[model samples]
Target: MNLLNTLKICVIAFLFTSLLNTTTQAQITPVLTHDDALKMILASKKHAELSDVLVNIAIVDAGANLKAFIRMDDSYLGSIDVAIKKAKTARYFNIDTGKLGELTQPGGIIYNIEHSNGGLITFPGGVPIKNKNGKIIGAIGVSGGTIEQDKSIALAGAKSLLN
Candidate 1:
């Protein structure tokens, strides 16, 4: 009887685990593809080149996870992490990092928010990518240049999907 009971419990656990996996898979939303990431990177790099600046770029999907990255030759090594964080910050809040920086300023709303979210980049260079339905799909970030230049590059990347 004990052996039979144990076998029944094992079957029940297997069934439950299978059900959980199916539910998780069904709930997952569409994610940006590698080709999409490459398009963003190429557009951003072109913009940076036009500005005569090398930069590190990062792309993050809707879940705020890093999906792709590129570092131009001679780009600042320190900016690699900054670029990733900027992408994540934009995706996490569904807002551009530049705008978010404005809110994080001293005495402004959401001040010190940079201290949260495992460290955020509360500066320019991050832009959110949105679908035609106005749903945020991802974000892009560029670093290793002046804030304005970085923002210009990031904006180019963020708009790549439109074309």
Candidate 2:
């Protein structure tokens, strides 16, 4: 009789614990929306003279879905697609595509994944956005400016999230 009672209690405890685990796992990470992406790009325009270089900025969710994309007036036509690829690369690989190139080197494990995905760019202007727990939930990409300028804009966008 005691053994049966103990078994029943253990089973109940196990079921309760399983439910708690499921609940925790289902909690979605806070992700940036389309509005947030646009605000970041528009707000950063004042940081420097964007006249010479029209900027293209894009943001993608963790699943690599395009949340938003913006191209400044006079920006190059290709900048939009480039920015989207950059964002996809960052979000898919869970790291800045710029860093991936170096970290993966020729014949390296990550190197193999460089272009396998649908749309991924390894250029310098892409960056990943992480939550407080250090989990990447999205990415941002910037183009239309010089590589350095684009990188700066991407960094600024990420920093804007922090603030």
Q: What is the TM-score of each candidate against the true structure?
A: 0.79, 0.71
The digit string of per-residue lDDT tens for model 1 on 1-163 reads 6999999999999999999988865554346778889999999998888889999999999888888999999999999999999999988888878889998888999999989988999899998887645668899988999999999999998787767
lDDT scores in order:
0.89, 0.76
The sequence of per-residue lDDT tens digits that candidate 2 reaches over residues 80-157 is 899988888888878777787675677776765655776467768988877544678788888888778888888777
Best model per TM-score: 1
Worst 10 residues of 1 by lDDT: 24-33
Between which residue pairs do clashes occur in model 1?
A: none
Question: What is the TM-score of candidate 1?
Answer: 0.79
Cα error of candidate 1 at position 82, Å = 0.6
